[model samples]
Target: MKIFRILQIMSLIGVLIPMGCSDFLEKKSQDEVIVTTVSDFDEFLLGSGYVTYVQYANLYFLDDDIEYYESEYYDELSDVMASYGFQSWQPDMWESEEVIRTNWETYTSTYSRIMGVNAVLDGIDKARGEIEARDQVKAEALALRGYYYFMLVNTFGEPYNYNKKALGVPLKLSADIEENGMPRNTVEEVYMQIVEDLRESSALFEKYPKRRGNYRINLPTVNILLSRVYLHMERWDSVIVAANKAIQYSEGLTDYTKFSGSNFFMCSYDHSEVEWIYGVGVNIQFFGPSADLLSRYDKNDCRPGMWFDMGEYSTNRLLKKDYDWMSGSATPVNTVRISEAYLNRAEAYVQKGMTGEALADLNEVRCNRITGYTNIENVPANLLEEVRLERRLELCFDEQRWFDLRRYGMPSITHRYRYRKSDPWVIYTLREKDPLYTLPLPNEAIRNNVRLEQNASAYEPKRSGVEE
Candidate 1:
């Protein structure tokens, strides 16, 4: 079948099903035939229906890493200035339909991809094909599903550390769609499902063909993801084990010293160091690094110069060259690379009181990014704090900082913005453990499915009469 026809079928699959079940499986359209052949399922998995990049634009807005110039020119652009609510730590940034739509898209798009994966899992066993081809398709789908769920839970559900018993996104296992409403699963249950899928994916990958592309998920990628999931679950020992396994199979970090100051490289997925790359493309025109974040980079650290540029107004805009801007290309706003594995291991080591091991791993990453770097012979008493700082500096704008802030005891974040050079600055503060830390579900989603429950914190009425 043609790709459009397949997508149409997928759309119908998404819409026809009722809200009762948390699984991605929806009732099939009467007009469409059930896809049973491995070839058709393989084509569908690789087709446009499968969302390759996950978009977390809302999460990016919530981080302390960005700054918007307060100016008459920017203020005239309502849509552009609207983002200020996110940066200013407003409680209900989802007031506008556009903002709500963007947030809602993230939820639906991710689940759509999950639905595609479920279709493959449901049909692969019945399809007649070469055993290797079938196994490869199944393994890839399983890994992709696991990854999507990980993203969903992290974004929509409460932080695992906050309350495992807290409500999580609905858990959908099978592809069979039904008309029953499903209650939210506990955070623990959702995590257990993610772990199960990823573990199965890891075992399946060993039997499948070697996956070479950074875009594709294989054993190493699966392990790296597992490391992240375990880190969130506070399974420190398991995190160390998973990170070490992933590092053993993946590429080492790129040495910044090799590139001249003027020729500093951008962090792109094509870079040899990236283990897995998946995220929506970011438009650098509207975004820039906060002065405070930029100040953290050491004079010798090459990343500051490489990832940012001073614009005409002297503002430090994120470098556009870091992403693929060509239409249809997957511009990764977030990624999983080999360096993260090292950092994951280092954090886990610090939690286990293995300061020396932690420092070794931390220095390993610093050695590559900082010029003329030297390793310390002893670990500091504040080794965990040191590791956290390194992680923030290293992964500044890649959507990790905000999540880190939440998981790290929800530290208070204060942002300062000025409308113009001569204007007094407006200050906004995000308190630790504030309810706004958790985003509310989109209004449309709740309306469409009455059974859906809103986050307690997200229930605040939208603010009105706020200055643009």
Candidate 2:
């Protein structure tokens, strides 16, 4: 990518640059004025990564709603996601101008934000902080860079283990130096890069004592993410180890069962769990199940509803700013919870042929909720079906539904079930393919990278069915 163009875009976004911060705001301090060194630059740059990381959640809607709901194809696909498990963008189901624009903007912005992060990592070393802080900062920055990459990789890149050699976007770790039209890297290569970054991050943070907030990625959060990555990799042994480490290092959830009152949703600290390594939450939630999906359940279900998944440590007043405006977890402090640890353990058991063990892990989660479930145990006869239900209900909008469905062999963006037009009242079963699997790399990115092969399915015409 051209440095000039990239810089221009970054400036427009008010990213990585302090020039846009003032109406000539007072005067600069002595230290601030002279410190144009890389360390200062690094500090400036590092903030951009956090910005990108925050936007990752915005992409949740595309996968769950749009593709999962279609004509007859809708009913079939509900087996994967959505409340009605349909009503999103199924080929041509949802055509509102507002929803369409929001959908478009949310998904695309994730890529744009990453460009800002790359800028900081590429040029922030002239004046590294004191020896200790300098190293710590780099570790956090590097790991976060990988964290953003992993999000993009999973969302747009095909499953790495399922198809090791599948093509994914080129690694753009450095904003200043990526080539225009960079070619796709093998999915394995993309994963290798992510693994390396996470491993480096884990080692550095383990040694650093002061890693409680956004400043440094903490031990528990790292293990949490590591467990997730391993599960995605289908590395059951690694998944088990990471899950155990997370549990041992941190406290578990806030015991939702014991929390008082009907308004339990607002408690940020419920179900005592470990502190998140890099937590960023806001009460100003921008997305929820569109009206069509919510029409299926009671108006108050806080669960992801086939859409998706929250945060804490509030110095920014963020936790309170939009607290009264949204649904799902109350307080802006959303979390990556203890439930994830159980989910991972259950998945690991599945791979080990210990179905009983998997069921136990799952039961542990189901039995704990104040909102109780049936004593259902002994594992489902259809193994994939069991995983799908557990993962869908557990992970919800946590951004795991699409991947879980994909990994389990029914990979498609379009809903699998079909719907009948005459019977808005009737739910007929049908399956169709209008897959929204991996994201289509932005037109701008693809145009810039000559070597990059566009996702072959990127331009599939919208039709009346969901993809398989």
Candidate 3:
């Protein structure tokens, strides 16, 4: 990598202040920010190592759960114009005329945070602190790095189960800035790293076992992440084991029946069900539920009424804003909750031919979220489908839908968009097993590293016209 690229990584974590290209080359590599205290590492991680929900906003648009409603001035609005490629599933999503698009923000943001985490992991061992405190810092960094890789691999690479041999994101395990860009790892290799980091995290947690707030990583959070990863890998027994541990350690589920107001139901970070509160608040005002997703909710389910604005065309709006939307601050959303552990176990049970156990898990979530809920005594014939439906309903808009869609065989999906009120709808279809399922490496990445190969184009050349 060039000095500029190395500077990008260093500057992202506030470690470098290179004045000019020529001047930076003369300075010693060790002349950078010096953070040598346990307190310094903790603050550094919190400030630069964390990712906001905005980093995942693009994925939310790609999932089938969202329905894009275009206005008459669609082409005039900058946001709508910029999002057109992603909303329509175009391969040139990050290289469009509407925006100066050269890179995927999600890709850059995630890798940047991973670099920050790497910084902490690189030097925290020698930091001045108690052994247990250093262990806590190390555990959090390991878990966070694993989680970041999980996001990157899922977004920029093919699904692990679909093709573990497929190309994945580069594994940057060290804080040392590279003079040459690294090659992409195999999907299997990336997943191996993720599992290793999480295992280390789990071991460190066992040593310290400290409870930060739900906003931070804990033992339960690590287990939940493991269960999710194993679920994607189709390791059913591993999912059951990890999810069971998460459930045992979690604070327990929040009963929807207890709250009549949907506004504050899941708005607080301190909610009982939350495992780790992370991610920036998404502007739900820009999107709404897809008809397919909306139909999955039962009439007796309390979520729809509480979670959505049920007025005319309210299906185009998500009513559940973040806890601090009333204020002018970003609300950190929870990526893992107690309900997910139940759902994970349920799906694992169904795969393992334990229909009764799966149904019990479904009932556990349904009973808490559904009003006038009736416990089904008998296992349904389509037990796996039932578990999947429940999982979708419970984890919708929480950044799981897109990945779920990918692991579920990358099903065909269609999005309809119109440029104006008078114009007919333009149909955009992502056919089953389409290469579009795996996003291409960001152009900036490929430019920086000739060793990196971009994924296949997502565009379907034959299917871009307006439907009459």
TM-score of each candidate? 0.85, 0.69, 0.89
Off-target runs (Cα >4 Å) in candidate 2 are: 1-46, 52-59, 62-108, 123-126, 214-216, 265-271, 277-323, 326-334, 354-360, 371-388, 411-435, 465-468
Candidate 3: residue 38 lDDT (0-100) = 78
Q: Pick the candidate with the highest lDDT.
A: 3
Q: Residue 322 error for model 1, in Å?
A: 1.9
How much is 35 displaced in model 2, in angstroms? 6.8
**Who is ahead in lDDT, 1 or 2?**
1
- Whole-model lDDT values for every prediction: 0.68, 0.52, 0.75
Better of 2 and 3 by TM-score: 3
Cα displacement (Å) at residue 294, model 3: 1.3
**C-alpha root-mean-square deviation, each candidate:** 5.3, 8.4, 4.6
Candidate 3 C-alpha lDDT tens digits along 1-468: 112133456674334333443221333254444565778677677766776546766676787888765422434555556667777777777666653442236676677788878878888888888888888889999999999999999998999999999999999998776666788999999999999999899888877544847367888889889999999999999999989888887778888877775455465655788767776656544467778888988887788776665556432355443434546666575456878999999999999999889889999899998888999999989888888988888888877888999999999988876655576877787889788788766676677677777787644353374584
Clash pairs for candidate 3: 1-179, 1-180, 52-280, 53-279, 53-280
Q: Which ten residues in a row have the lowest lDDT in candidate 3?
A: 17-26
Candidate 1 residue lDDT tens string, 263-343: 553536556576665555455444677778888878898877766665466332655235234355555444567878888
